[model samples]
Target chain A: MVEPLVELKGVSKSFGSKKILDNVDLKIYPGDALGVIGPSGTGKSTILRIIAGLLKPDAGEVYIQGQKRQGTIEEGEPSLGVGMVFQQSALFDSLTVDENIGFALYRYSKLPPKKIRELVERKLEIVGLPGTGDLYPAELSGGMRKKVSLARAIITDPNNPDNAPCMILYDEPTAGLDPIASTRIENLIHDLLFKQGLCRAYAIVTHQASTIRLTTERIIFIYQGKIQWDGKREEAYVSTHPLLKQFFSGSIEGPIP
Target chain B: MNRILSSSGLWSWIQRSWAAILLSGKAIFFLITRKLDFSSSLEQMMAVGPASLLIALVTASVIGMIFTIQVAREFLQLGAGSAVGGILAIALARELCPVMMAVVVAGRVGSAFAAEIGTMKVTEQIDALYMLNTDPIEYLVIPRLVACCIMVPALSILALFTGLTGGLIVAQMYGIADTVYLDSIYNFLDVWDILSGPIKGVVFGALIAIIGCSWGLTTRGGAKGVGQSTTAAVVTSLLAIFVSDLFLSWLMFQGLGQGATMIGQ
Candidate 1:
């Protein structure tokens, strides 16, 4: 078995008196595409935040490449590279699309501005958003903004190969989009993760069944702060886990509510 | 019973403000120990400095003219017309330019910082910065802090000169002789007096930046929160300026005894 690149062991989180996550364990191996499916506010995004070190788990440990995650930016870099595609795109409104895509490069790479722009254009092309370098986020449609945001996350730091993100976390990779736009995004994710062969592992938190079917090989169903079901994508449809069936069937009358 | 109820609210507010101050201090400390983002700082300077130049100049000019109109007429009637220039210079340098310019900036630049950062906070842009391995304090707050510290002092100096020009114009129209007006300012305006306003400006600038950014970082509850933070930031910055001004004025001028020695007769 390939060594797990990222792991969450006995993880838990709470806000005020409400528990958000409880004793959750998860693992992602090299080259794995995992789908985390759940009802809204069921700690899917929270899990991604913990893995990225943006938020600390109230209990339990997060490990990257079998090493314990370190706290604080001053600590040496973690063993695994992590990138996040935010649900809202979250592209800096003040920056142009190219500037947004090239931000990490500009901040952390030694590449000249000309080279950065060239690389940004390349990423834009990869996302099927060619010639959008000059446009701002506000000028772009919702779908375009989402694609540009993904480009920003996955744009490699050519100068520092070490900074290249291998683990990508997609929060709602296709939300608030027309079906055609969502298909485009789903194709882009497929191309980036498998066709281009850039990423090692990915976890997508999304409601779209097609997105899960097309992008992920493994899936986990989370409900009420616990992993209620875990299995391969093939098993998702056949497994008669009532909650999973309810979710997959889009049926209102089931064990889910 | 009323005191008990209000004290809890007051105490929580104090704790919140204290946390913000501590965060600002940490951001400032990061300035000393880390590589400063000069590009961002320069951008903020352009926003808080030259961009604010027109309004600061206009406000100073109006205040200077008003001071001269009110005082020059009365002083000339009393045979102390020459004293009008010195008094205007003193008041503008010691108090008017710094306080008034700070008020303008608190309204404009400070509110802007709070609004921008507050929106960023609520929209998860700040969280995105963190996910990018960018420290918000280092990337955001320090640049604004450094920009305000540099720009506000520079603006205060410009405001001082503009105010003097306004006073000179008003004095000429009020029939005070140029020689009398110029001579009085030359004789009475000590280097120490002139230095005081810009010095105060540096302090005021830091207060505005810290308070604005702090309130912004502390913002919650979404769009409504951003609005509330912007209003509170401006109000807090203004109050801070006035209260600090009293202490700064007393400390800078105490035991200086008119500061006449700095300008030999």
Candidate 2:
């Protein structure tokens, strides 16, 4: 059997008797664009963090490209080949947009300054924020910052192929964004998967029904840290699962909450 | 039972402080073992060093003048006025310059470090660093550490010179001859006395930087937490400096029977 790019096997996490996640198993194969949809504060983003190796699980294991993730990020082994774009855009406020995009490359890649700048420019162009590399994160609009953040996450280091992320996790990429900006981000996600095809897989944790329905081939519904429903796009809209129905229909009369 | 109960708070403080110290030790170890971002360290030094010079100099100068004013009159009345510069030099070199300069830095640079890093922690910038495969110690703490260690000692030296200049001005006001004061300094002060101040500066600098960075890194909550960390960092750094000064003074100057007395003479 071909191994998945990333896998979570029976993973569980807790904080002081509060079970944030429990017995969660997930897999992302090559070419998979998975959307994780659920209510806010129900460990949706926590799943992304776990997959990105920002947090440890209390039980089971996380695997990156089939290797069992073995050390903490501080230990210098931060789940190789996984990149995450945080909900808040998390750009280095001290750095310029290009500098933030080129940060990991400038640190780890053997690429020279000129080449890194070129790559950064290309990423900026790809994100539809061209020629804005000199601007700082504080100077950019919220959507612009998010786009720059996405550009930062997926900018491939050509000099060092190993530094390239095979998969990316996006946490609430459209949160607090207007419909136009959200659609732009959604289109960018689709283009990133189908056009550029640099990364093999991605997991998006978002509440936007449009983002989930358009950006993902598969959707997993998480409620209270467990996978409440998992299905294809067509199946998701038609599923008789009460929670999924409630979530999709935006109905208050359901098992949720 | 009472003792255990009474000391629990102290024990908890020790545990927390020790963790911060251990993380600082790890930062140092990483600095020694890994490739560091020297550009960031350079920027930090530029921000921390020359920016702090005026205040450090002013404080040291005022302290030197005050010490001279208090000592010169008493010594002159006792017919021991020639010893004023020597006493000032000994006191400033042994304790005053380093301790006071550290206090200034802990209040200024140290508090700034805690607030900045604490803000970063609360806002998930630290987490972003981790996500980007960057160690916070290597990226943040070590740069600040290197800057503090270099700048504090450099500032202490400047403060020492400024202090001596202050003493000279005060001596002139008291109608004491420059020759007599300079001669006293030459006769009573040694290389060890001057060197001790810089050594203390290095230790105090490390303590301030480590405490500030650790407190910031460990900060929870939000803006309120950052505020608390800033205050705690400065307070803890001052406490560490004072307590460590007592031990460091004893270690650096203890059992030096002739040298200690001769410096004062």
Candidate 3:
């Protein structure tokens, strides 16, 4: 059997007396696209962060492939090959497009600036944002910033094949875009998956059906931090999971409150 | 009901407060523990150095000009004009340099620190740093603290030098008597005079870093929180500088004596 690229086993997290995640488990196989959907603040983004090693779980284990977690970030844990594009796009405003895109490379890679620039430009083109190198983040539109961030995430992935997580986690990749822009982004997400011959194990946490339908091969319904339903995207409508029914209908009387 | 509320309720609140303090302490302690080798800190210092030089130069020059113009006017009107150079040296070297530079830099660099860190905190980029086995404080705060501690004083020294030169230009251009000018100047400042200013610079740097980083780390209200923290860092740092300046001045000279006094003669 092929090894799963990323897996979460019985993971749980809590703040004070409130439990956010309980006995949650998930897996993404190499070259598989996973979409996580649920109500706002349902810990969908939290899961993405956990996978990225951003948040520590209170119980259970998170394994990147099969490695047992051993240390905090202070330990300089090797970059788990997982790159994340944040919900806010979190691009550095002080940095220009070239600098922002080249940030991680400059820090971690010994590549010359010219090489990094070339790589950055190519990554931007892959994300449908060509020739936007000198612009500061504030000058660009929100959608453009998100694309730059995506380019930043993907640029080094092709180079660091051995060390980094092949699975990328996108936190609400299309959250604030207009319908047209969202569709554009949705298409970009698909194109990126196939373009680089990257592993298919990306987990995109989003609320838009258009994005989910376009980008994911499988959909995992997360509600109140536990996995409520897991199946192929085509099985979404037929599945009688009450949470999905309530969430898909976009109703007021649901388990979400 | 009253009995239950009296003990456990108060006790719980105390425990919560203690926990919060401990958590913040852990953040600081952990950052301190994970510090890179001195050579790495040295490298960061080297990088942050020349990048910040130009701003310090421009600000110090302007401050010098203003300080000289006003000081020359006061001494001139009082028939002590020739003494303008000495007064300028004493005031600019001892107080104005550190104070003005602190306020200027606190406005420029301090706000930038708060905004950058605050965004990282909100977006979980900081947490991302943690996951990658990077201590956010070690990766972020140490370099900032080291850089600012080095730069703030560096800027202050420049300001004092320029302000005193500015006074010299005023005295010479205005035709103050060279005899009184030199006498008053020599009478006022000595090696110890200049010594006090750089000391203030060190304190100012610490104040700016502590307030800016603390506010940035605690930011929670999203964009508004980042903005508010930026504003708070500048206001609190500048105010703290003024208050501390007074206390430092008192302890250095006036508190030890009635006022400024004779040095070893």
Which parts of model 3 have CA positions greater than 4 angstroms off? A71-75, A157-160, B1-88, B123-147, B161-176, B239-265
Distance from true location, Cα of B68 in model 3, Å: 9.9
- Against the true structure, candidate 1 reaches a TM-score of 0.93
Window of ten residues with lowest summed lDDT in model 1 chain B: B256-265
Across B96-136, the per-residue lDDT of candidate 3 in tens digits comes to 88888778778877887788888888876675455344566
Q: How do these models rank on lDDT, best leading? A: 2, 1, 3
- TM-score, cand. 3: 0.78
Model 2: runs farther than 4 Å from truth?
Answer: B1-15, B256-265
Model 2 has a DockQ score of 0.66
| Winner on DockQ (1 vs 2) | 2
Q: Give me the displacement of residue A46 in model 1, in angstroms.
A: 0.8
lDDT of 2 by residue, B1-265 (tens): 6578457645545655887979878987898899878899999998788999899999999999999999899988877888888888889888999999999999999999999999888878888899878888889999999998999888888888899899999999998899988888887788998899999999999999999999898888989999988998898999999999999999998764343354334
Cα lDDT tens digits, model 3, A97-118, are 9878877676667788889899
Which model, 1 or 3, shows the larger DockQ?
1
Give per-residue CA lDDT, model 2, range A118-214, as digits (tens): 9999999999998998999999998999899899889887756786889989988998999999999999988898899868899999889878877
